[model samples]
Target: MKKFWLLIVFVSILFSCSDNNTSNKNPYIPSYSVNLSIDMNLPAYSNLKFVSNGIIIPNYGAKGVIIFNAGSGYTAFDAACPNQALTSCTAMTINGINAVCSCDKTEYSLFTGLGGKEYPLKQYRVEVIGTVIHVYN
Candidate 1:
């Protein structure tokens, strides 16, 4: 009877265990360390001052980095589309607070990073110091 109870306990423990394995993952893209800063006072970056607006900085990351000024604060994300193939056209362009991928027209919200795509947009870190905005990964 003791062995039977031990076996039952072992079976119960086994049944209670849960597996956390998840196969739904984003595309495999190499992570590159990003460190960039922009002056919001500049004419080119002045558009970032308003909510639901963003600007793309060239020559950074796989494609570039999109900086957005959300209503709460600011956010930065990789310009590369997370759902599509990595190509020049896979880069995202700013349309209000949404980042639109030119390849498949996948639009991701700049504020929440969610959209109709399979995954959310790849995001970076944002730090604001006066008129200067620093974006990094």
Candidate 2:
């Protein structure tokens, strides 16, 4: 009886496993480790204190990263356009609450990071502790 239960559990575990790489792969942007800390008290990062505002910090990700204030919390995303390969014009620029790709003119919302056709912006994890905002992969 114990052997039968073990076999059933093994089969269930095998069936429940999924090939996550095949489904969630984004072939455009190269992966980079992002460990950034932004102080809201600083003059350069003070703009992030308000909702619907975003700031682009260079020398971080594939094409730097854009940190946005989404009212409820903060969010960060790779500035590279996810629709195509990294090119001269692939770096996105902040326009209000959206990040616009100069290459294909694709507009990605900073609020939800949704834009383009299939893949959305590669978002990093954001955590706000007091006045310090921690952004990481």
Candidate 3:
């Protein structure tokens, strides 16, 4: 009858909407883990830019590029922005002491690794051993 068809249509619409909502949800958490002693040497990092291969290390939290500077005896951060998840632009560009997410122009402080009035970038733990740099979750 007409009522039965209407009920089926309503159910179908409900399920479709639910599916769309679930698909749009951001379920990714960026993290990574790298052995500093073996992967990166601290002395070599000084005053130079060291970039990691696009490796998704789970302990670090999400997919991102790790940039290290040895000149200032400092390391920078670019925790992939969760806001720009679906695109190929997963890496953040470093502008002096800031990490800029190119997708939406979200800027994060490289010194603090905190987002500016936007979404916060997940920071990984950094450990230095002698001349080695280690990045982890």
Candidate 4:
């Protein structure tokens, strides 16, 4: 009876194990301090108040931070292209809800942050509640 209980506990622990997002944690994307919040209802952020749209908020992240309203919620990404060394041209431009890297002409999906590129844009944490959109690294 004791052996049976021990086996059950071991099995439970094994099934409860979880994996981390190591793939998304890229080493190439330089880490910089970031902590910004914007009210989506505000006139300045009105462009981002709608779904399937993105905006670049200056003075944040390595290049800049691009935030998008992807229908579900908001997502933040580093504007620097993850494919190569960071440069001026590597800075991404907002095209609808996609981020285009002029350096290699690669585009990353603003919604999922993964498309038309080997490496996805470095993403940051985003929290939306009420009318506030918080982005942090």
Q: Top lDDT: which candidate number?
A: 2
Q: Can you list the residue pairs that collide in candidate 4?
A: none
Q: Put down candidate 3 lDDT per residue, 9-98, tens digits, no spaces.
A: 554334323323221133444334433332443343343434222222222335454444423333334356645663556666666656
User: How do the residues 13-132 of candidate 1 rate in per-residue lDDT, one tens digit apiece?
Assistant: 332231311212346345777899899899999888886688889778778888877655677777888777775475788887688988888788776566775776777767789999
Clashes of 1: 0
Q: Is candidate 2 or 4 superior in TM-score?
A: 2
Per-residue lDDT of model 2, residues 15-93, tens digit only = 2242223212568877788999989999999988887788999999889989988766677888988877886665799
Q: After superposition, how far is residue 24 of candidate 4 from its true place, in Å?
A: 4.4
* TM-score, cand. 4: 0.78
Q: How well is each residue in 1-137 modelled by candidate 4, as lDDT tens digits?
A: 99965664453233223232442466667778889999978888998877777888877988889988766567788888787777546578988757888787777777667766567778787877789988875
What are the runs in model 4 whose C-alpha is more than 4 Å off? 1-24, 88-90
User: What's the TM-score of every candidate structure?
Assistant: 0.76, 0.80, 0.52, 0.78
Residue 97 lDDT in candidate 2: 77
Error in Å for residue 13 of model 4: 27
How many backbone clashes are present in model 2?
0
Q: Rate the local accuracy (lDDT) of all candidates.
A: 0.72, 0.77, 0.46, 0.74
RMSD of 1: 14.3
